[model samples]
Target: MAVSHYTLPSAKLDKPAKLLIVAAPFYREIADDLIAGAKAEIEAAGATYELIEVPGALEVPSAIGIAERMSNFDGYVALGCVIRGETTHYETVCNDSSRGITLLGLQGLCIGNGILTVENEEQAIVRADPQQMNKGGGAAAAALHLIALARKWGGARKGVGFLPEAEELRIAGELKDNPTA
Candidate 1:
């Protein structure tokens, strides 16, 4: 079988931005490599990022979710590894984590998932290698792309002359300009 490798062109931002990396360090070595690559990519694009550690793969999405709700990160990178074993827990972790991240994206949060799902240590090492697959960098790029898209759509940045709901209703003739009642 032929293997295909794909990468997003480096994302260039229009302005300085902040990102957060939520890493699950079950495998410390692998997680470190992923974070290194991700940070490099983010900085290369003229952006800054803050890093935080979580317990395991399952918690990665939850950390991002909480940050999305209560923090100011412009984007997020999710880094972790889940290796398959004899038990079914691997599938649960991988599936639920991915689903959660997807849900957050659907809600319009920019997120890059660098979590590695592998069948063995060798595969994990190859995928996590900063000089090899560089999935971490890829994830950062994905987040940047989403951020760019959001900015393009004016996410929360209404155009000039945008008005509040009450003003808009009056302008649309939905309400009287001067009402006593």
Candidate 2:
């Protein structure tokens, strides 16, 4: 029932980061507003971003997944609007797109999901407005937080095979113990 949530300030980063915004422009105006807010948020966080358009909400996640595999972005923002009409297609779009984004996040990719699933255009407009609910900015903020978390825990190690150097040492040790030696 509530779209407004408490936002945490973005963490200060020692270095600049690059981000990708994979947006679905299904509702041109709505998507535009969402993208605006997301851009503003990313700028405020001092991160550079690239914007790419997909055909629909479902494709937004797929695009980010591809970028995660092939690109060097530190995080991603997914933007789209899925308005409910007189059909069950609404639920499918909303649920499946959201699930796809979640799965990507679980795979260690920092993603901000700003897709709006609403009963009507009015609700989407209200939520997408930068001066109102600002869901797009919220999503951007979420991604930034996750990126900070990733950076905080990055570097240093706990296990063998985690690094190539450690793996090679382990292989050498195994070879040393071989009976043929």
Candidate 3:
């Protein structure tokens, strides 16, 4: 089958950011390649990162959640490889891991998910290779993009509820003075 790729837009940030990389090295070689690519990408964007290893793909997301709660990382990169096996474990890992990441993202965590769910080792190698699909680098780029967006909108927000006392009094005075009844 033919493959197509579309890269997300990247932008320079106003300040450098820190990222946490949660990797699952069950497939050591593949995880190494993925981590290398992710590091290079983060460096290219003028950001720094810390790497932490978990047991497998399923644990990657939990690690990220822990770091988010306990650390001050600006973003996260999740890297793992789940090759289809003889049983249904592959499906569980792939689905639950992705779901966790998605939930974290919905909660406003900037994350790049590089977990690979492939049919075989060959496919995993092709996708994880920095010189090939470069999924690791792609994940970093995704996180960077999210960080930029968060910073761009990180400012004082206007409240939509009740107005402050001074403004309320001023409006009340105006209404009293302009009464047509």
Candidate 4:
């Protein structure tokens, strides 16, 4: 397997941020690990978070939307695991969930997607560990990163100032690597 490394950005925790976590219970084991990892990162960043369970991956987007509409959370983390099956149902769920989450981000809601789209259980196990470069934590990091950027950009607007070329390239790579909704 190819090795990959990520440098976590320093979290400015002068004021704790409120976070909402929407998790799918269908894949309980994997989802649990992802949640645990996210919780760890949230605490480490000096933030408070709440976890809300949903029936499955398909429900994550709606839950996030409702939470965003009703609550005052600074960000959201969506956690789920979707493993490939005999039919094309996996593809549909993956694509729709990803698109929905991406839309949420564009709508100015900070969302961290820890949803795992994999071929089997082994891959899920490897990626869910808190100490093993958790994608869950990575998602949380991305959310925080975006939140910081949004603030620096002075809230939502039709157009924004130019991002450093290197930073833009880095974000593009991250989005391509994990296309979750």
**Model number with the top lDDT:** 3
lDDT of 3 by residue, 7-38 (tens): 76665789999999999999999999999999
**Candidate 3, TM-score vs. the true structure?**
0.83
**Candidates' lDDT values, in order?**
0.87, 0.86, 0.89, 0.80
Count of backbone clashes for each model?
0, 0, 0, 2
lDDT of 2 by residue, 30-63 (tens): 9999999999999998999999999999998889
lDDT of 1 by residue, 69-173 (tens): 677888999999999999999999999999988887877788999999999999999999999998898898899988888887786432222366776777678
Task: Tell me the tens digit of each residue's lDDT in model 4 across 1-181.
Answer: 9997768675664457888888896877778788888888888888889989998888898888887767777888988989999999999999989888988887788888888999998998889877775877877777676666666667453222355565566667855664452
Worst 10 residues of 4 by lDDT: 155-164
User: Which segments of model 1 are wrong by more than 4 Å?
Assistant: 1-4, 157-181
Candidate 3 has its poorest 10 consecutive residues by lDDT at: 155-164
Q: Write down the lDDT that model 1 would get.
A: 0.87
Descending-TM-score candidate ranking: 1, 2, 3, 4
- The TM-scores, one per candidate, come to 0.84, 0.83, 0.83, 0.80
Please identify model 3 stretches exceeding 4 Å from their true place: 1-4, 155-181
Question: lDDT at 17 for candidate 3?
Answer: 92
Higher-ranked by lDDT: 2 or 4: 2
Q: Give candidate 2 regions above 4 Å deviation.
A: 1-4, 155-181
- Scored by TM-score, the top model is 1
- Give the distance in Å from residue 43's predicted Cα in candidate 3 to where it truly belongs: 0.4
